[model samples]
Target: MLMSATSFLASQIRSTIAATVHSTNTLVTSLKSSLGYLGKDSSTSEPENQSALSSVPLRHEQYPSLQPWKGLDRRLKNYGYTMPVSSNYIAPRYPIVLCHGLFGFDKMGPDAIPHLQIHYWKGIHQALNKLGAKVIVARVPRTGSIIERAEDLHKILSTTMEGSPVNFVAHSMGGLDCRYLISHIHNKNYEVLSLTTLSTPHRGSPMMDWFRDNFGVGLLLQSEEDAMRKLGEAAKLSKEAVQEASDALHSYLQNVAGRVMSSGYRAAPNPSPISPLLNKLIPYLDTPAYANLTTTYCKEVFNPNTPDDPRVSYYSYGASVPQIPLWAPLGFPWEVIKAKEGENDGLVSLQSARWGEYVETVEADHWDLNNRWRLKIGYDQKPFDAIDMYMNVATRLYNNGF
Candidate 1:
């Protein structure tokens, strides 16, 4: 009876081993399929194409206004990106200068900290260099007016490129800077062959107008005074009573604003609590950068004064996502832009992004254009690859003989 029990146990062990082997094989096969490795036709084993085929159709059905990828090149239809860069791609004749937009930087953080060093252009510069294109990533003040940033960019290019003609591929506010440079800052030291702008606010953004109207201290105070006046009229209160109420509201708002500023100061790297006088003065600081982005300013002031240069070829591309995700950092801003300007890529509207020789709009957001948002933990599978789009930009420049 003991011998019989031992044989049964050995048989059960063999069966368990076989089951484990089968499950392991099945899991490997599933992974291969998901990665586009086990396609029926092996020749067209592009993972992006597979992903696009699955996701684009569903998205188009849900959002009819979203540009359909039906007739576009199979590779670009879904994600607005090209195939991986290969040896056959031609490099542009002139060196490509990449300009960053508002709050942009060349690099940030220390390299010693893992995943801390952030690049504004990300892997785009290296990819362009790998394709035999000389690339320069231009850095300027994060929040300076167009002219101020343009002057800085001019100085940097004049020193670095040293008279070499370049193609300006500016993104967002960077486009405005390049346009200002091309029109105003004509240093005979360097020549600009072409200016390609991606999602630039050439006309201006309604979102900026919204921010000014809703959040500006002057506007907020005016709105509150109007409300107080209406309350006095309805309640049959005396004019003095209304005035007193308005003054109290103003004082309360000032105290609240002071506390908010103090908290922000304390959160800074080296905290020195700002005095009440400085807190009051902060709102009146002359920050032209934010003011310059307003629709009224861009339409009435900047665009009228800064005309496009005839000597340089100008091309602009707009970006749009069907809808902002719930977790997107730009969700509220996207809604604001969408309500006023229809479809937008969070910050700049498609209507505003248009300028000299408008190119086709692509499927991306403002941050996606720079590959910044894609670095987040759960964003690895995003279809739009900024590297591929920039590669296509270089190819287009080469084809145009720039």
Candidate 2:
């Protein structure tokens, strides 16, 4: 009986080992196929058609030099993501207009203080210009409605390009501005040949909705009456004092709201424990961008009104980071956005970023899309050079005869 039990136990162990080996082999084969290492006809020697290659998903072998961060495979497989070749970019036919997004600027400091000037596009504009592309960095309002931004963009383009056909490469909210311009604003001065958006929230972001619902609406509801009552009591000593004070308070609140809400992502996270002083301040901070950027607003209002122009070619690239570190500035917001949307680059989701041709998705966050390398820390799972990506866009436009 003992001998028979020992033999049975040995047989079970052998079976388990065999199963494990089979599963491992199957996984390896699947990975190989997904990475473009298997299922190819070995006899085929002809190069793939350029148009056909564009449609085919990029493979790991295509980017031989991409060195992802160490241990990234153990945490989250890099999969050798899609990024443009580092060199040899063909300049597009028309000048490339680089449009900044919400709360963006061409330069921050005054011209006299050139050493301290901070550029929105950073190294991107200079890199593109070096590659023989005529780059125009457009300056628009930091925090304005889409219509307002579009109007400003149109004016800038008309004056700068001067009847020259131009290609627009917009990031974040700038993409919406360009779309609005293309669809609604008709200008005879300059022609829009094409628009390529990088990580733009075309459909709108859930983060905006979350901010408005949780903090913006609550602040407005709780503080307005209290602030007015306090102001009225303070000004009651004089004969028309209350009325004058009320008017002054209303105007002051409007100005404060614009300034505060317009700060965009730079604003501090929503703090729940509102101090007495903060209660008065919070209610006055109106989100001017909320009406323009909420998912509901874009889907129900902006999209319906802003249809794509047939004359212009539209293409877009979305981005995503595998993980958001605990200490990352976008950590809380990333979780908030991820809860509603499946995958995102800490700001815009991959699904929401898709528009027009839908080129490809890269491994990056919102700031990384703008070529802000200094902002990226301890989250470099993939080597996605923003400069290279822009150059690739220019190359694509050139190839398409834009």
Candidate 3:
């Protein structure tokens, strides 16, 4: 009986080992086939034709074990998936005009490193153009009064597109500039078909006030008040840093300002004059103009003056990324903005971003809305292409015959 039991145990052990070996072999084969398939896929097609995040999904085809089982695929069909690349399929009736906001630029840095020649709109311009959209990147003043910047934009559009009507996709303060241009500068020579603003502070930002308080009134002045302004003027500012956070110190200072401003408004019912220091500091900051963006100012001053143009169609896209450590590049200011204004896209709040036909709020920070350029600048979050957003917008405009 003992001998028979030992033989039975040995047989069971052999069967178990055989099953394990078979399973291991199957997995190894699946992995090898998946890797081989991916290698072939890469060499077979040009990089541009493929989605940036396609490799993971493409590899799954070779491995049945790795893929979702039967019914799960149907449920997840629409979730977190990218639209297939439609080459040259997104042409709009009018040219697509891209307007950059305050401290924004068309292109910056040396041409030597091709990636460093990053546009404020990032990869969207090139991608749109490839898709047969006539994309024009407007180079406006980095920091100036709305009127000044609008006039500059007027000059740019007038000179470049020869006064033809174009679809205006403005970001941040650029939306304010377009509105000003439409309200005040519309004529036979200047016409806009559509105005789409992403993360614009239609209702002014308290950050402007924060700047005045922290750096004193001199911060707002057009002339150099402190090292910050001087640095802004002299430095060839990083396009990402300019549109997003300035630096670690500035971000920390902004948090302090946000807290102070929130407390001040809570303590006082009436809006008081900005500190006497601001009065002493030169008005170079366009204090009144910047203030016009504030909720109070917009409701009182700006909205009253700049009504929507009936001819130009209006749309706005808002963004709200998860706070802080979600994207370290956006820094501490996002926390402050989130604290003061519910949800924010690092800079512009969702409420403040609302203007014209409220399109949709996306899950992206101000910078995340565009290509962070992971391969190039090392500041990227993959699978969230700003180009895709722009393409979708352009496609919609085309479908709408705009």
- Each candidate's lDDT (Cα)? 0.71, 0.71, 0.64
Residue 368, model 3, lDDT: 60
lDDT of 1 at 57: 26
Off by over 4 Å in 3: 1-89, 110-116, 217-293, 326-329, 374-383
Query: What is the full ranking by TM-score, best candidate first?
Result: 2, 1, 3
Residue 133 miss distance in model 1 (angstroms) = 0.6
lDDT of 3 by residue, 122-177 (tens): 65676677777788889876766565678788888887878677999988888988
Best by TM-score: 2
Instruction: For model 1, state the Cα shift of residue 349 in Å.
Output: 0.8
Candidate 1 lowest-lDDT run of ten? 259-268
* lDDT at residue 201 of model 2 (Cα atoms): 86
Tens-place lDDT per residue, model 2, 57-161, is 543346543345322432221222223333446788889999888788898888998667777876677767777789999998887666567878888877788
**TM-score of predicted structure 3:** 0.60
Candidate 2 Cα lDDT to native = 0.71
Model 1: CA > 4 A from native? 1-84, 111-115, 217-286, 374-382
